[model samples]
Target: TLSEIATMAGVTPSTVSRALNPAASHLLSKKTSERILALCDHVGYRPSLLARGTATGFTYKVAMILHDMEKDLNAHDWNRITCATSAFLQESGYSLVLLRTSEKGTSMDMQVSHFLMSGIADAYITSPSMLKNNTLEMLNSLKSPLFVICEHGVPFPVSDGVLRSDADAFKQVWSRIPKEMHGKICFLSTINDNTQRLLTNIKRAAWDLGIDANNAISTLSLARTSKVPAMEYAEAYHQTKKMIKSFNQFDFVWCISDFFALGVKDALTECGRCPGKDVFILGYGDLETFPGVSEKPVLSTISANTHEIARNMCSVIMKKLDGEHTDIVTVKSSFISRSTF
Candidate 1:
């Protein structure tokens, strides 16, 4: 088919090959390349990814390893991050492959080793939650570059790293609180691995403003309780209502997620406190645009800017591919104003 297309376009197989490869296509003239491409299209010729990879020693696929593979993929933040990553990579002639740390309770190290040895991906990307000792060993052994994305801006030893600083986001929301309400700030989140880090960041933000966090910040973790990712909304609703029944002693409330914020808002209202007037509420991970969520959300929140993070990740990968070194990148979160605050 290559020779046939070359012949039809009055060119040699070498020229046709150059035209087919995106990186090498620039070597040919615009007119010649267009002619060859148009002829190939006319004859319904499609290049095989496997064949191209075998010949060039590159699969053009990036593997994104996940820590909690059991979590629902339909969750808004997960969906946004993955979709944005995939779309960005696709623009640069690459594809994304999702690999869970464990599958059916199998060893994560073994799974990671298998994928590494198979040589199916050109590069690797992962978060701190998914990084393991042996897994890091395998990734280090490979010549392919590894990129790390820190979801909560945690420090890690990596040449290429991207940090989406939840601290900055929390700080932005904190500054919006009225000065009088500084000492009455209440934060509510479900128990999870990153809860402490998030809490620390929130307090650190207040401390940076010369506020004594010990006296100003109060935290509740629903008392050692955890909910599945999908059922967080209902869990937050019931738990928050119970808490409100006992005590409501805060001028400003900040939640780890929009679901929790919504729960707190409803609980406050049902208990005779107005969300905007009697108390102020803020949340993270803007959920107004999420599927099955209300378009007209009343809660003020912070956006993680998943699309921007995806672009930066791809930019780092591309730089590595071009034999350039990049420093750690920190993307700041932005605040979205709404009726609640």
Candidate 2:
């Protein structure tokens, strides 16, 4: 059937073969490859994995380790980063081994060591739940090749490069808020470098604008555990809710995460205060679909643009593997202004 079709198209079986496989498609002209694929679809042609594998020395597999799939998927920047990284990895001729490192029994450190010990994957790209757990410190000490997705100490030992969130420079953006809004502004985030960086940056901005940073209090949520401790989120909700009560004048509430802020929003509603109307809410990591969630005080946020983050991490891996050394790169953040002013 292949030869018959190739003859009718005035092309050799080898041309058809090249068109059938993506790795070989470069040998065929773009139009020829397109026509071949179109005709192959008509004939239901598929490439044989066995032959392809023998030709290429690589199984083209990569292992990705993250803390929480829910948060990882729901998180705005990191989610986009992982998805984009996966796409790039696939197109670059590699498969993904997605590993949820911080499950109930498994420690993130152990997960990294185990994967490294297995030696099954070509390389590793890890987004250690730096905020959720204290794993980033430990993950840094490992001997394997790794890429970090968060900010920590100066440099990582095992990590040839780091891809950090641009939230560190967020203070620059927050500083631009009106001088009157400085004391009225509240910074939010879980206890992480990026969160602290956000606070530090804003506080500096606040100071420059003659605003008191103390007017804003930072509240940390559940540790980066496999599953957020049942009470951690609840306690944070209550604590923030309670803190909100102490404020006689709070104009803006900055939350590190949108999903987490949703919890805070719930607490505010319990107090009979309408969000966005009575209080403004700003969130980082524009993640979560807010499924079955109604519009209560529009939540404004900045997206982490993880697509670039992921791509950068992958590029770092490729460069390092090629004996190139580069400094860690930070991914840019995006802002969304909702009615939560």
Candidate 3:
């Protein structure tokens, strides 16, 4: 790491970023940089914003807006949003300013205006914040260039939606699963306006697959804790664990996320049912970065491509920002097929 950092810093494999990094901004003070950097070997330190900017002419700072900081501390859907945004922003030469209620002088939503107003960031992109939050509601009222990154659905004045690539696989999982596998299939998803968009896409895909999503029972699985429950592998497992144990007439289990799918897996295990084998289990948000139901013999899942989502969302925003759109451009989820069916 020191060697890598030194190479990046360019002084020597021994010169550390702390020595050269500007303390006023976000790193060590000049004196400290000189003290330790001179003595220490560059063991793989990363370039600080100020130093990198001087050379590249780019600070790469991105102002990422999210309502809850706790969500990142304890990952859930919010984590997915964070990862995707960071990956895309960095690839395009930007850093992130995680806007929360406290960071902004007054409110969370105001953080965007505050940062943009101050000219701290080159552009403002909307991070996945909950729809129910008061700050988020206020944000919705303002027409910010905020693009929806991994949003559950499109928000108002915020069209150009970006999300993971694996969105389309929901239907395939349902089709492979027998309608009779469970007495009634239960779909556990986050409760928000985004639900409609997700359901809309799923419904359309399901119809194409000859599956009627409207007929399916909807069981809500809001986040009780952002942390994925250990009882089952995913949130879907815990959300409907009781139902599964009661031998609830549900035939199949569907979840909006792999976190939930893991939950379903555990529930099935408890009920003596086989996931992907005897019973059908499905998950959205195919996380190649993180392991999910794909490894399970009976589980099927769709992986979301953050890269594609970001690219598409950015394209839509550039056009809209340029006054090129009369309405919003919707980005749907992609599909990843595993043996879970």
Best by TM-score: 1
**Which 10-residue span in candidate 3 carries the lowest summed lDDT?**
17-26
Model 1, CA-based lDDT: 0.76
Q: Over 4 Å off in model 2, which ranges? A: 1-28, 39-47, 66-80, 99-119, 130-145, 152-162, 167-169, 189-198, 201-244, 266-278, 288-297, 314-328
Q: After superposition, how far is residue 295 of candidate 3 from its true place, in Å?
A: 7.4
For candidate 2, write residues 1-341 as lDDT tens digits.
66866886689988887787555689888999899888888877665555555665444567776666676665445556677888877665566787666643457647666765656465767664544565555444334466667653334545355545444345545654566565566665554434565566546655665556676444443434233423334644666666666432566677766755666677777777777777777766655433344445366766666667778777777666556776677666666666654
Off by over 4 Å in 1: 6-38, 72-75, 103-111, 132-138, 191-193, 224-226, 245-247
Tell me, what's the RMSD of every candidate?
3.2, 5.5, 9.0
> What lDDT would each prediction earn against the true structure?
0.76, 0.62, 0.54
What does candidate 3's lDDT look like per residue over 169-257, in tens digits?
Answer: 66555566555542376666655424666667666767777666677545555545444333225445565665555435555666766
Quote each prediction's TM-score.
Answer: 0.86, 0.68, 0.61
Q: Which parts of model 3 are misplaced by more than 4 Å?
A: 1-60, 76-81, 102-113, 130-145, 150-153, 159-167, 178-183, 189-201, 208-212, 216-242, 245-248, 287-298, 311-331
On the 0 to 100 scale, the lDDT of residue 26 in model 2 is 90
True lDDT of residue 87, candidate 1:
92
Worst 10 residues of 2 by lDDT: 223-232
Candidate 3 positional error at 225, Å: 7.2
